[model samples]
Target: MPHIFTNRLGGVSSGAYESMNLGVNRGDDPACVRENYRRLAALLGMERGRFALASQKHTDIILRADFRHAKNDVFDPADFVADGLVTRERGLALVVFAADCVPVLLDGGEAVAAVHAGWRGTALGIAAKALRELGCAPGSVRAYIGPSIGACCFETGPEVPRAMLGLMGAEAEPFIVRSGEKYRVDLKGLNRRQLELAGVPAGSIEVSPDCTFCLHDKYWSHRYAGDARGSQCGAIVML
Candidate 1:
């Protein structure tokens, strides 16, 4: 399995997008976005045409993809809406976009999945859903929880903690902190806990220490740049 969580480096887009903007709908030039994908494909040693991207809506929807879904052009409108993509097809890359949202990559030996987990998706346990979609024993799956807004800066309203608590109960407490009238949530930790609860061994899961909000200059961060910024991606392929 080959996987990569890209940053805001090594691409052609400029302005607020700067370079390495993989998002096609972020108002970046289509030509530049395509060239970015070319650079990414070259780095991965995979064809650009074999990439299948997710139309993320912050939902828990996971779609099983194949060669038929591959598209070389990022401008192509995604026919399906899903926050996660799973595939067993060799050479076909599964891609999920994120800025402040957590991007999770799963490798189950024969199958791989790329998931976009925002606070809503995390509360829905989208990672666990993707794991179940892999149809593999959780202990055998390897997971990577990529960069996102960390607890140090992810202050939110009560609804965020409420949703997490409703889904994970007491297990969600330690990852949350009460900050006056607001709350600070650790999305990466919550996603990791979801994977562990779904049966993935704790040692098999790797969490990135990088926080997108803190490292906004290095990675795209919605909290830092808002709609003026571009998006990065987490891609995986079974080869």
Candidate 2:
């Protein structure tokens, strides 16, 4: 799989989204965001302006990448809230922004995906959907689970873990840690399980040891700085 993760460490965005913010339509200056994309492109060793982006909406919507839709230029900044992005073409970079949510990158022989999975998306099995759209059986797919809110920091009420349990039943146990009145949710673990459910081998999955909530200097944590903070991103490309 295409290895990728971008924090607040690189870029030109100022104020909340700070520098290197790849979120195009988040009200940051268009030129600054473009420059940030340029930096990310350099980091990924590709053309500075040729990255395929997605419009995320916290749902399980995933689009297939082929000849026509697989343009190598990133210019569509109208509505970026699609939750997941998948592609089977080389040189077309794919990305998804996540502050408190998770960035799951899946890849194999021909297809790749970068997905934004919040509690809602995880409950809806967005990763599984992306795997299906990638047209690769789960066994061959390699998944890189990028940094986000970890279990120690992601304390949620019953609703979040409930949805996970509702969908995954007993499979959600190992990922959810109960803590008296609250629950410590392991999004990475849950997503790993989802990828496993979709057929990705457990050994092929790699979860980031970084936790955004504890490492503000290394990442953008919405829970750390509230709405004034910038965002982080996960990007992948076919090679």
* Poorest 10 consecutive residues by lDDT, candidate 2: 71-80
Which lDDT tens digits does candidate 1 get at residues 73-177?
678788889999999898998889999899999999989999999999999999999999998889999999998999999999999999999999999999999
In model 2, what lDDT does residue 235 have?
88
lDDT of 2 by residue, 88-145 (tens): 7787778788887999998877888889999999999998888888887778989999
Which lDDT value does model 1 have at 164? Answer: 98
Choose the strongest candidate by TM-score.
1
* CA error at residue 117 for candidate 1, angstroms: 0.2
The TM-score of candidate 1 is: 0.98
Quote the lDDT for 218 in model 1: 97
